[model samples]
Target: MVVGGDAAKEYVAGFAAGVATVIVGHPFDTIKVKLQTHNTKTQVKEYKNAIHCTSQILRSEGVKGLYRGASSSFIGMAFESSLIFGIYSQAKQLLQGETESIKPQLQVIIPSAAFGGALISFILCPAELVKCRMQVQGRDSANSNYVRYAGPLDCALNTMKSEGVKGIFRGGFTTLLRESIGNATFFSTYEMSRHYMHLQLNSNSSARSQQSKILSDVGIGIISGGLAGMAFWTAVLPLDVAKTLIQTAPDPNSSRDPFRTLGSIYSRVGLKGCYAGLGPTLARAFPANAVAIVTWEGAAKLLGVKRD
Candidate 1:
């Protein structure tokens, strides 16, 4: 039997997932954005590596620095995850139709996941734009006059007033590309891993008691989700690096085309430049997404969403 629930249930579960994500992942995300934006021709590299970055943030700005733009991310990710999970569930259900197979087909899963990702990009872009800008601020310690945003809302208002509505969506296309491709890889890997683990663990899982089955599912979900999270960053860190650069550029008039910007980065600094922040990103991926999936599953269960 296919595992799923009504769209509303998935949305609620996904909100829980998103919240878990930000809490576990935001510190790593801050390091990733800072790494991506700082190592450029025009700017002096502020961090030698993820360790250096973490230490610097700790010493200078305290733990709060690592969560600079978390408020915006919390809001954005809650809505984004809700929509992405809801759309993915609904689309997969629609695509599967009357099919009775418990095993997920890539043909159905990839497109469904990608479609959800593409749709959520619209919501993600502005929130990320604000988040990136906030994350990258305070780097210029020498400039005593640099004014930081009071908060997420203040940052958004300032961006809108200065760059207009378009400014809020500065790196939208990059966000779209990243989400669509990354999510396709993400969900596909999770489903495939889950299926493999299910087969290996139980020749007769269905015969197990409800509690045993739930426990098995939770264990499998945690591993699969972690692997899936790692897979996502491995597939798209270069694109993510490009997205960060585009969103956090000091010059508003800078090129916004992600591919072209990536090309520029490649020309200037080669492959390493395109893959900036790989360390913290991969480190953050496994635990963050594992928690997200666990939370999601727990929420779904609490809400009485049905499963296999």
Candidate 2:
């Protein structure tokens, strides 16, 4: 059975699941982003791999360092995921017939997912700004005059104290671009994968009758979500690179325009630099999205949502 409701329940469940995923996953996420956006020219490459980076952060900064910006990450993820899932679910229902059979054209699902992706970027920008700051603070402190933020609250308070509320949302436009485009690709990819999986299962002569569909959905969801995550990072690599630059770029008092800073990055690194963080981003996306799909499906079932 698939879940049914107006937008409210979908949003709430998405928010809850997103929050849970962030709390469990943000530490790795932070590390991943930091590695992805690391300034090799300036910052010394400390750890060899992701595991090494994690251990180094923990050793130097303590466990808290691993969980830096966890609070803001949760808040940002809650809003972003809630909005994305809500819009996706509602859009899916609107686009397709309420039938058990998979739809033939995967293209029909893309617009709905794209719309959801665009909408959630608004909710995600500020929190993502803070998250980027926290992730890069260790490196920032090494070269810049910026005082290190202890955690999400510290980052927020400092930004508000110095730059006001606007400071907190500085890179919202870039975030919107990244999330919206990324999610459109993500959802479209996921739906297509799911459809393909369903088709394969249906064609199998010895497929189990009672559990085949359920297993297929679960398998498809996992693969699709992971693929979507991969597609998202690949498509939005430049935006993410720009976002990191804007977030970590020194304040105006330091006499650097954020735009110019980003331009400098582009000039120096070119396309390759823009994709600096793809490796870890891809690593984290698979399990994180797998968990998200499982949770969403489980919740829908628990709530008696009738699946077609």
Candidate 3:
């Protein structure tokens, strides 16, 4: 019997990971969103690059500008992470069957992770829609097109009222593609990295103290998690750019298909346009996901959750 833990505890572990992700990643995410949607509602680009965007936000709106939509992100991430981790763990278990001690095959890992990512899209689309909309509403007095909402709740309600429920989920398709592909890459990379790291560590465990072993586990988690995050964004950042465009378009009726949106962006600004926020995104991906996985593993251990 898998006596240490069950599937439900995965949700609790996931919730901790989600909170950690937002705290470390939200600022970078804000900058990424801003850079991606810089010209959405205006004729001129407000930011030349991530550095310029960050400096401008600090100058004009202070640090708060970078956290505009974090409220929604918190709620979204908490629920999103819980569902994703829980679903992925459950799926992986079912797929692995009685081979609990064996390494997970790529076939099982990718499909199980992708399934979790796909389902989370329904939740992520709306949460990100609100987050993007809020992030783009800058304090630039020159840009008169900004639609300022009182808060995330206001943004959600207004979107619901104006565009119906579909408005809240404006970038559903793009989000689905991004999440599914990104998560498959994420879990696979993490698993592979951790597997190798564990092999290296186990060979030396007899020579190390218990405290040293704990520290080594944390170090491994950070490296594996950071690598997983970078891999995820590298694979699906173009889709994320399209999703931002769709979500933050001034016109709610803009094309929602990610491919169509990408084509339009490519025609206008070439490849750079398709990867507008790559810098900040990659920068944020490492530490944010590092913390997330560490927190997740810690929480799982605390909750007595079992893992193969």
Candidate 4:
């Protein structure tokens, strides 16, 4: 029987893992976003490409700029990953039942991921808002006189001052849609792959061992994470593109209709524009999710969680 106490413990452990992950990976994430969402005609040719962009950021903004919005990322991840792993584990346990015979199949995994994804979206939206704003700062159109926000706090305060609390949640609905579907694909693919790997190993008794299990776990995690990220972005690239526009739209007073916004994006850049951020997203996902899944599983083991 999965108790509330178990769920709480899992949440805390997941939160710790999330903190560790963000610390290590947030800088890369910031870079990825900047590169993916680079302004169209900035004279800052230093950022005209990825390598140049990275070096320029390092040279100009120092290490701190690489980690801009990291604090908000930590806050967002704490709630998002914690709830995701916690709910995912609990849901898996509930659906699969406390039995060793439970086979990892889409039936049990997909819904669990879907539920976890929905829960994480609520936590991800606001933090992501802050992260995007921070990443794009100082790079806005030079001709414009937009107020410069110093950091995450300033962004938040200024957002509230100008647009009220609701401003802070801009694009939250699209965020929810993207993350829910994206993470659903993420966990479902991960669990299904892990199960297949374990099953293959177990089928050959000679291959069944602790080392094999560890290897299988890591391999499945990497493959699944990468594939899932690809699947996610491909499936919802349009929504993601729209979300980015809504969150970073230069003019806050611009029309807020999602359909119109999506249409404008499509017309301006064609379908390819919708997938502008795929490169960085894939790069970040490969490592970030590898760390996330391995850490979550390792912590679960340390906590003596057993599949039953």
Candidate 5:
């Protein structure tokens, strides 16, 4: 039935795209999470950089270590991406109205994207909390000193049992902030870039060159998507660091108020702590997001998503 109509097709497209995207980018995500939550006060930091981190994981935990917490990511992305892309398309359309403008206005896109981000943050919070905690486990002497969850499901279940439902929403405020700001920048950048590219590439082309135009659009999508991805990460990296710390904190009994988590990060490591994993996060942004946005766009096109 989902394949029987446009709305269904959109859902299916987003679901499939999310699955493919997590596969392509999960290792990079793992590294980024580990880096973000790394405590500098430890006897020694777990890794010096992305390279050393990858090397250590491979040498110590094997390839599986690189994929730690991926199951949670898959579950998170499946729901988060579907909700975000689906809601964003609907919201953008409402903003665009029945006028059928030739192109989307920035005013229409910015708020729509922000709303979508805000909506998905609630869904993303719990899954992301489990994912980050699982990813960073075993690295710490405390976790090494005790038992860890069997997997993401176990982590979520245990968290719920011990701390109730609200425990899963750790860092929810920061997640909301990060998603809203990042996604606003992300969608706006992508739209503006793609529009400019269209103007440049299609200005002189004719009907006979349609294929070339399509190819050009694909190329433009990659670049624009990369730019959008980078903008999102760079704008929200500090908040993201705080979110990771709150989500991965060993003590669920401890408060995870956004201001408190932020203050803790600053107090312990100063400004640099908030940007701890910036290098790896930026490195992951380009290729991973380029691929995700392209795949999402390509899938949406096939499913007739025009506004987003």
Candidate 6:
């Protein structure tokens, strides 16, 4: 049975971290999404580089523009992070059981994390849809077919009204693929990185055991979380590009095959199209996710979560 307080702490920690994530990293996310959806057409294109995009947003819409979708992102990610973390911890507990001998080894962790990733995709779909649609608006050309959403609630209502609830899951396949692979590696990286960090920083075994019990250092969490983000993005960015494309499509009803679009983009722009916003994404991933993971772990600890 799941312990009540433990899950509550996990949820709260994840929520706090999710808020920090949006505050710290939303601008980079905005730029990354913008770049990912940039048009290479001859007539009307806005941003040329990450720096240029930052400049454009600052100039045109001021600082507030950089946080265009902050509301949707903040709220959605709060739930998204909370669910991912709380569920993952509970799932991990279930998988580990009372077998202290198992040691949360790679065999156990990889699959458990994958399970959490898959389940979290349910919440991520709508969150991502609203965030992507909001981010891509006003940036499109005057003749573009994109729709402007007033906010997250309006976005959800309109989407459901026109296309039904299924429309909320527009790019769900890609989200699942990305999150499953990404989180599998994320947990693995965190476990291994912590062990390695203890080795490098703690010369004495007793000292290491006491000091590095669990998320003892914010820096370690940041480093490992950043490493995990790098691993996740490097492995799944092409799929992410495709996911964003589908999620941010203009006509909600005008459906084109996702697999075909992935193929078409790959064939047209080679690997470049698939990796359009990689730089900014990587930059954001490290700091953003680092803060998130650290906050989640730290908050759980403060709220009385026991060390494994």
Which candidate should be chosen as best, given TM-score against the real structure?
A: 3
Across residues 62-173, which tens digit of lDDT does each residue of candidate 1 receive? 9999999999999999999889888888888889887877787999999999999999999999999889889988555456322368788998998889889998999998
Select the stronger candidate by TM-score from 1 and 2: 1
What is the number of backbone collisions in each predicted candidate, taken in the order shown? Answer: 0, 9, 0, 2, 0, 0
Model 3, 20: alpha-carbon shift in Å? 0.7
Report the C-alpha lDDT of model 5 over 21-92, residue by residue, as the tens digit.
678778888888888777533435668888888898888788888888899899998888787776776777
TM-score of 4: 0.85
* Per-residue lDDT of candidate 6, residues 1-308 (tens digit): 23545778888998988888898889998898888787421224467788898898888778988898788888878888888777777877778776664233787678878888898888888888888888887554477667777777888788888879889889888889888888888888887886678567766444545445554577788898888877878888887888888888776754435566678677766767778788898999899889988887788778887665
TM-score of 3: 0.95
Error of 1 at 52 (Å): 0.5
Could you give the C-alpha RMSD of every candidate to the true structure, in order shown? 2.3, 3.4, 2.0, 3.2, 3.1, 3.0
**Location of the lowest summed lDDT over 10 successive residues in candidate 3:** 1-10
Error of 1 at 217 (Å): 1.8
Name the regions of candidate 4 deviating beyond 4 angstroms: 1-5, 39-47, 96-101, 139-146, 205-216, 257-259
- Runs of candidate 2 with Cα error greater than 4 angstroms are 1-6, 40-52, 95-108, 139-144, 205-213, 253-263
Off by over 4 Å in 3: 1-5, 39-45, 140-142
The predicted structure with the larger TM-score, 3 or 4, is 3
Candidate lDDT values, in order: 0.87, 0.70, 0.87, 0.71, 0.79, 0.79
Kindly provide the TM-score of model 5 when superposed on the true structure, using C-alpha atoms. Answer: 0.90
Task: Please estimate how well model 2 matches the true structure, expressed as its whole-model Cα lDDT.
Answer: 0.70
Find the candidate with the highest lDDT and give its number: 3
lDDT of 1: 0.87
Residues 161-245, model 2: lDDT tens digits:
8888777777777777777678778777776776777678778856576686677668877787778677777788767777776
Candidate 2: C-alpha RMSD after superposition: 3.4
Total colliding residue pairs, candidate 5 = 0
Off by over 4 Å in 6: 1-5, 39-46, 101-104, 139-141, 204-216, 254-257
Clashing pairs in 3: none
Ranking by lDDT: 3, 1, 6, 5, 4, 2
Candidate structures ordered by TM-score, highest first:
3, 1, 5, 6, 4, 2
